[model samples]
Target: MAGTVSGFGRLNRKRSSNKEGKRKKAVYPEKSPTSPLASKLPRKQASSGLPLPEDDNEVPAIGSIYASPPIPSAPVSRLPARGFAGRGNCVDDTVADNALTASQHAPPDSGTVVRPLAGKPSNSFRDANKRPRSLSLDTAETPSKRKVTAFSEDAALVPTKIADAHAQVIADEWNEVARQSGVPEIAKITFINEIDHEPVPPDINTLFTYLDKDCLSSVEVPNPPKAETMPCIGRHPAFTDEGLFTFATDCKIIIECGQDCSAASNCKNRVTQLPRTIPIEIFKTVERGWAARSAVPLVRGQVLGLYTGLIISRTTASKLIGADAAYIFQLDMDEPQDADPSLVYSVDAFRSGNWTRYINHSCSPNTAIIPVARGSAHESLPYTLAFVATQDIVPLAELTLDYDPSEAKTFARKKYREKSRSKILKRKRNQTPCKCGTLQCRGWLPQM
Candidate 1:
């Protein structure tokens, strides 16, 4: 998530930090610049007649500095530092200069034992001239001190989210799922929060099952005959004994000839056949919730991995999609097209899935799903897809895929957009505004 800052009081001020307190003490001069004592006194004794320390690092006890017969030393505090221009006319360059000069030159009077503040001295001080001219957008929208929080849907901010219902059950299940799937109990997720100080953990159910390999989802595989009729993309025992089938005749010949499925030279279709072993770290975001980033740079066109999840019937999908549409991918191909489109299949990673489940949507995506039919006897519709890099991706780059890949070609061409108006807007009525923050962002994730 992009950086956000909101909190009560002055976040920059440290109560225990004596140096910071003193430096920011410029909000008020020792005395009103208009005071007759301030104008008549020399710089060395100007700061409320306080016995200023010789070293700039030392802070005098905040009270009247001078004494003929030192009056009983008493405790006092300065509070005007919280607001930049809160003192209005009381603070000015003249008073601040006089105070600074006096504090620097005045020697400590041994008779008046002023207590030096505790803690390491900090040299930090604000520019004397710089003050808040007026509140800007940042100050205008600052959250109330009583309510500072980070939630999902900022679109570009870091990610996090939670719902109050069924908290315990969700947490238990989430912990079990993550533990079983080899996910760490805690990951060093780096994302700026609203306050960027205190952070609240997401509810127990915010994690994924962490699939290194594809696994069965809540919905089981179809019956043999019916499943066989469905088009298969890559090899899986559910579809075939050898678990190898493709749309390419050459690939079929090569793979059946006992070639290594791991090497590119051995099989062009091998990329999808193998498991995704790339170093991907799934981290929580400030506003986007959980997200994934690559640990290493990815070459353009490199096949990342096949998106896997529970293969559910359209009926099962209908019930779940309403709950959350982000992780449900429709899996249907024209070759094995169902007479009733509603009877088609979809993959839902919400309950159980791989790292790919954390990949979020981007209007202009870095990855594209390439449906590669294995080189089998005949071509079939791909039940799942392989995410291939559209461009060279840098390490730690958040991997994103276009939810609606069909919208790519029509981006620049008004003619194509006009022609495909029906197609583009087909899902518009059901979608939300896109927040990918790219220059070429289409303005909405039509399928978000």
Candidate 2:
């Protein structure tokens, strides 16, 4: 498209050194369906399989996202072979060029060049024989939210570090807060930042405990609530284990078989086994407190990590001390998702959980939690839920979740959506002030 614009010359000829009849490969980001600037978009035939993305903590069917097939497949044939369209197919000389264009181009009032021999057509006023000055990246935008079908093929595109003060700390020390973040060897978590005299976080090991995996034994420690608290974790203690879907009979066979689920190409168990492939960071914020972010550019459908925690029931959670009620995640839909059903299980991350605890809520979040079942088959609910990217995240863009995705939700969510829902109590405050800074801020976090 770039080489062959409406007013441009045909640029499709092969180079002298290129092998005869051989073509160079190109990878392009998918055309945004809602982009107003898109005049012509390459045809894309979306394929559907496990639509919810490859997440290790996901159940067989959690949610759906369209998957683009291999580039050599139907998707690639529709796009051009070469040339970046940054200047688009045609670079219009006369633009209502914004601030960036003005800084990089000669002014219209600056006047024309010296006369050449009689016949040549005059160049545009903005054009000159000399090269333009380099522009700042601030004026440029990253295609973080843009879709790309051929991620693996675009390995040559190296990601650059961004320097937004809000999105990232202005300056930082490359520090590791904890020795291990519970992520796999491939996935990494860097504890960073010390800008503006900010205090470095104390070792998390000194806080409560570090649990790489969920602890099922609620074995009443010398202290209270170290292991999962319950009659509680094993078997459904509730009168009825109604709406949850346990592993299928075949799924149970493999769980008992002890064979690595990877051996089977069609293994349904693989749905919840996809670990994170990107690196993440835990950074402190000014007004909002601690948060998490990706250390590099990330694709839209990638899963970041599991939201590991203690297994506690809604009945048990109701008895949680005061503000501690803010961290229980309702497990697989044991009850209708839309209704505030009194019965169900929840994953409590207050005392024991992983890096996901640091992820804050945003009105317009880039990440979301999807349901994911774990290795244990007998457990009535799924273990270790996951944080899936809702859109492509640029480097250092804060990772966020919508604590209250919809107002018509469950008790734990409504209760913990913020610290509280009403500020009328004791003439003090009830709900925590939301500082997500999105245009869609609901004025207050939905809390009860």
Candidate 3:
């Protein structure tokens, strides 16, 4: 019996020692259970829904669980105040009640009115609901293209005197030449003159005047002795009442006409026999300005005269007949634009002197001229002018043009007078007042 008791006491002491070691280990964080079976079993009590040891610092969930927090069923007045709407302490409750009522009336399964996704606009609203943008329209208006008179019917196609006389001369010449020779010499005299109803001033020479050597000597570039003996050509004609030629360069001077020389015998005779008495106006050129300072007059079947020591600027080179208008030509594009869309042309650039100048400006011109561009050999673009719309003009409409290349400037001073001594003679012959009744109408009176 003593041996049995002694053995039992020894076993108890070992058990107690094991329990003490376990208690000491548990004092620190206890090791997680290593047994798979133990891990599978759920804990009976937990802090924050986790094992007690792992979630020791977390809150407990006794009343917070199925019990719910003690929602103070104390009077609704016991709740806090709301910032918006200043409703009573039951504001949240009231909102919830109202929402419930609204939701009850709404379709079943309808979603709550959630705010739009961040950065996205609400689909419920329309642009009209936003503030109106105020805009001022004072500068929005623009002027219009000029409205000119159309051509007149039942008018003579050409000058009556020239047409009748030339017709007779052509018939007689054909009969005589054909009778004498196997082939008749077909002569087509290109008639070049003013087509507008305006009387060209008798004093203003229609032909261009070359600067005299004496006049040239007065300017910066002294003329050679050879140039002095040479005849002076007519002056560049001015289209605007401003009397300024836009193309006048620093190197060149513009001359005015002393007498009407559209169809004169010669340059010498055209100039009134006054001692260098013909009035001449000079103009200087500047850089970055338009080359065609003045709209050069052109006519159908007329020749252009190129003076020596003068070269067409690259910009205006294309405007020559068989040459594309440099200002408007663009070879890379399918179509070419006009250097000046406002001015109408009767022919493309070709070769002559006075005949080219005779082409007149028409307010309601009958002719529709086409200018073409021919590409250059070295350049991607060409130099050439193709005359289109030559057949469009009627018999008696006045040939006119917008003096300014800009459509706006031309339309502003849309009305212009066609003045000439011959126009007065025709007006008297026709026995009509010199009136077109345009808004910018130049009233009639004899050439005063």
Candidate 4:
């Protein structure tokens, strides 16, 4: 997020920095003739307080030096010094007295001149001068220093104009993404609450900001599908801490043939049922304090609730799953070697609801389920789950994934135990009733 600076404040700050640069440029004089003349001019004399002449032939006192015609000596004779008494006696009467004086005085044609020796310094010279004007080496904006320090200080701020331009480009890119996704209305995400020093956490509050009517948003994904009329299911599977899930759906499935089929026989039923256990082989560390959950068949990854978008892994899934703690599940994948399936629990999260009973028991679901693979061998690992949409989903539509891989009796028994155990425990603890109100709701549930 860009820093929070008022328009005028930013303008003033930019103006001040520009003025400083200009000031530095001005401080060192340049190479113009005037500057040279000023420097060359003899400074005030130490003994007489009179300005000294720069040229060798310039006479100190005009009146006495040119009192008479100049004296010319024999060709080899040395000229007599004229400052003392009787100094004129050695002169011969051939030379004009004013010749030397007139020749030594400044030429009449020199244009109206200001202080001499002042000119704009060259780039090299000005750069040298700027050294002292800049922050000290320990606190400066050298290339490396700029990268590190610019984040917090104006020393690093790109020129305000430059930053604004870059920001505009970013805004344009976001807008384009939104447009291509058929949700041009979402492009309004730019001017929400302007972030400053503090950062908003990746939670429901921050998520809600994207949905705020006043804020601008860009659709991060493209070509989302449309929804169909059906009895929308309300069950939301509890995503494991590792970000995996299993789900239940309210809609029924129909096959091309008369017989009921979970998926097209050609594609195989790999995606239809809940896998036994997702080996913890499909996670990757993307940054410090953050890892990504990857999907095998789709070859896509997500940063859990953070950036819910596509990503790639520098390290393989096994490396990622090995780093985190073990997770367990009741189902297992069809094959051990395949990278596809629903092992993306590391990238999933509950859409928010009852913390418990999030494990939706489904006999069959329209969506495909993948395992959260942690290790190659997969023993002693915890189960994580993830779901993919078989068809289009609408906003606020119930999201589900097939959780129960077994038959009805087995599925019901496991769910009954899980629900009753939690319910009895809640009653013993005198907890507030859960309000989910699912048909099979255990008479009480946890409230948000």
Q: Give the whole-model CA lDDT for all candidates, comma-separated.
A: 0.35, 0.35, 0.19, 0.20
Report model 1's TM-score to 2 decimal places.
0.44
Give lDDT tens digits, candidate 3, residues 1-448.
1111100000001011122121111011112112111112221110011123233222111100000011112211101112212323223546433422321111111221311111121111022112111211232111211111333332322222222232232223223322221111332112112222111111111111221110000011111112112122222221112211112111111122221323222332211111111111111111111111112333332212111011122122222221111111111111112222111111111111111122222222222221111111111011111111122233222332211112222234524234553664465452213232344322221110
Give the Å shift of residue 137 in candidate 3.
72
Displacement of residue 251 (Cα, Å) in model 3 is: 32
Q: Which scores better on TM-score, 1 or 4?
A: 1
**Please, what are the lDDT tens digits per residue for candidate 1 over residues 315-425?**
554443222334556553221322232334456554445566667667666775544333322111223356666677898788886665445435667875565545655
Residue-by-residue lDDT tens digits, candidate 4, 1-448: 0111100000000111112121111111222322221112221111111222353222111100000011111111111112111323223323323322222211111232222111221112122212333323344322110122323454224322222232233233333333332322422222111121101111111111111000111111111111111112112321222322222211121001101222223322112121112111111111111111212222111111111110111111112221110111212121122322222112111111111112222223223333222111211112123344334433322322222222222325866667654656556353223222345433221110
Instruction: State residue 7's C-alpha deviation in candidate 3, in Å.
Output: 99
Off by over 4 Å in 2: 1-186, 195-207, 213-271, 321-323, 336-343, 374-376, 379-383, 408-429
For model 4, the stretches where C-alpha displacement exceeds 4 angstroms are 1-175, 181-334, 337-410, 414-419, 423-437, 440-448
Query: Using TM-score as the measure, what is the rank order of every candidate, best first?
Result: 2, 1, 4, 3
The global Cα lDDT (0 to 1) of model 4 is: 0.20
Task: State, as a TM-score between 0 and 1, how close model 2 is to the true structure.
Answer: 0.44
How do all models score by TM-score? 0.44, 0.44, 0.20, 0.20
Model 3 spans with C-alpha error above 4 angstroms: 1-187, 190-310, 314-354, 368-370, 376-382, 385-387, 396-399, 408-448
